[model samples]
Target: MGWLDRLLGRRRPRPIPPPLWQQTVARLPFLQWLPAADLARLQSLSEAFLAAKQFSGAAGLEVDDAMGVHIAAQGCLPILNLGLEWYDDWVEIIVYPDEFVVPRQEMDPDGVVHEYDEVAAGQAWDGGPLILSWQDSQMAGDGYNVVIHEFAHKLDMINGAPDGLPPLHPGMDREAWVAALDGAYDDFLARVERAEARGEEALEQLPIDPYGAEHPGEFFAVVSESFFEQPQVVAAEYPALYAQLALFYRQDPLARAQAAGSSRSR
Candidate 1:
């Protein structure tokens, strides 16, 4: 219902892309280091996302204007370079004031124990509704943001399988992504187990985020949070992982954080 859109007799934008300023805001922290051209591209994509979707906070948390801005800002964060196109498949976003415990009952492999645990907030079903708890929306200790973690899962689900992999762009090798992530996943598991065994208080520390070792899928999601929020930590601690993610995401967030750090010192 825009003037130029009306002039062209267009209806509903026909999935037109987002604009540069929007993308920049979506990648707020990363914007500190993006080159002008790349920043503009991100901005454009964000613009299109705002134009295309209707965001609403659910439950007791009213989706007010400020809430809309916050949710849109975080929702689009995962797709800054990728654009908001992947998110088009889903329509609704539900937000809770704090972590919503999701209960699940599953049978173990041996078929003996039925176990259940209350886990933090999460996104669910493909293109369904992205569930989040604003309490953990901000950076947690070691910089784990639940909003980013769950949203990353949704992005991975774009290709119809949340196997810890999202659709890669052309010229990128799928096998490389697999190998790199697989190696890092194994290493992290071993490291965590060893730390627990040795009872090394310092060894018990997590490189990216301890939650990352929960599973391959969780590893990917957790690492992604570090890649964006605390890239320097991710890079210094997991260099190879950082490099591979750089190839996959087509962005150097760690470098960006370093640059931003340098500027802050001045």
Candidate 2:
């Protein structure tokens, strides 16, 4: 527990009310595969999250308990096994009604400066608040999850700047992690380049989101979203990276999804 938590009277989190939890879990299809024990832990985590962080509505979006719980659930998922301590750095979440634009300035190699607006579904800052679009927040299924993408950035920023790499655990091999992610990232970029050369249709059919190839940090966030939402895709396309992620997350989403499939079939 941090001094801030104690000061704010948020050190001990109460359990999520059963009714709110039921409604939240029911609305979020992606959380259906979590084990019962894990779900219980997630409830506690959500409570802690709601207590520790402040949520603000933007652009006239009303932030309510249900909405807050939903966000908290998604935010807590990535850190379910990792623990809430990983997210101790930040304290606020700002949600817009839809996609928001932020002005950005970039300097060219020739020293020319360009300024423009970049539309974004979500953004995470180092030791700062997380910004998200409520429209994007409600669009999770198949492979898109704004909450996961932004929180994944939080994980990446734990050590320093947003690179694809997060702090490795004791048993995890850094060299192996580097080799796996780097090789997969290179291969993905080559695949995207080929797809672009072929056509738009080919680009759409690519195994994972091409946005991942944008940068190592984006790759980590994009793939993390895919890993949880569509683990089969990650397992099929980037088996090595998927394996490393499974090792890091300490959860086998592929196997869980397969089990769910079998249960539904029977």
Candidate 3:
């Protein structure tokens, strides 16, 4: 708790009534698309997340109720099947107004020291910090969600360094999760290589992020965007992938987003 937090009382925010909270949720695409009764439950879940978590803005970013609501909504989406307790292991959220540059040091394959840095939109280190860029955050849509990506990493890291596996709940089969994600990951890898071979676009409306092609851990995190932001695309092109995510997140976003998309198309 910081001096400002203690002074202003933001380590905790009192619960808004269910009706009012649902109205707050109605502003979001993911939330609003849920069935009305489910949306109400989501409101209760988000309220718990908001009350229990501490949010702080870094690098000249000012935290506020609206921002809290936004992050809380997205963060809670993944664990709706579980609870806010899914996030109980981590304690802080660090937000920046835009991208942040992090210095880097590495030894190349040649054993020569290399140093470089690049501005990143967001990053989530296991059991450490969840970092975000408000610019990309504010623009989250169409299955492109930085918050979901990083938080998914946090889930993946629950056991250790993100290896595309989050701690499984009772009765959930670990091998099944692994097999499903591995299949999708292998398919994405082949697509990337094929595109590279033919000099074609490698990431034209990919169901998962191109960056996910880097590693299984990254694939889990990036595909988490589809788990929340782009359920329809994933459901349409990768229903099994959608099914695996539906089991993990414990939410039926395809049903909701499909309904929303159908309404829009109609």
C-alpha lDDT of all candidate models, in order: 0.67, 0.87, 0.76
**Runs off by more than 4 Å, candidate 2:** 1-11
- Per-residue lDDT of model 1, residues 48-115, tens digit only: 55556555555667554344444555556667767666787876667788776676677778887675
Candidate 2 accuracy as lDDT = 0.87
**lDDT of model 3 at position 243:** 81
Per-residue lDDT of model 2, residues 131-216, tens digit only: 99998998877688999999999999999998999998899999888888999899999999999999999999987888989998
Better TM-score candidate (1, 3) = 3
By TM-score, highest first, what's the ranking? 2, 3, 1
Per-model TM-score, in order, reads 0.78, 0.93, 0.86
Q: For candidate 1, what's the RMSD?
A: 5.4
lDDT of 3: 0.76
Better of 1 and 2 by TM-score: 2
User: Distance (Å) between predicted and true CA of 80, model 2?
Assistant: 0.8
Q: Which lDDT tens digits does candidate 3 get at residues 1-46?
A: 5333442355454565555455556555677787777766666777
Q: Which portions of model 1 show Cα errors greater than 4 Å?
A: 1-44, 110-117, 140-142, 198-204
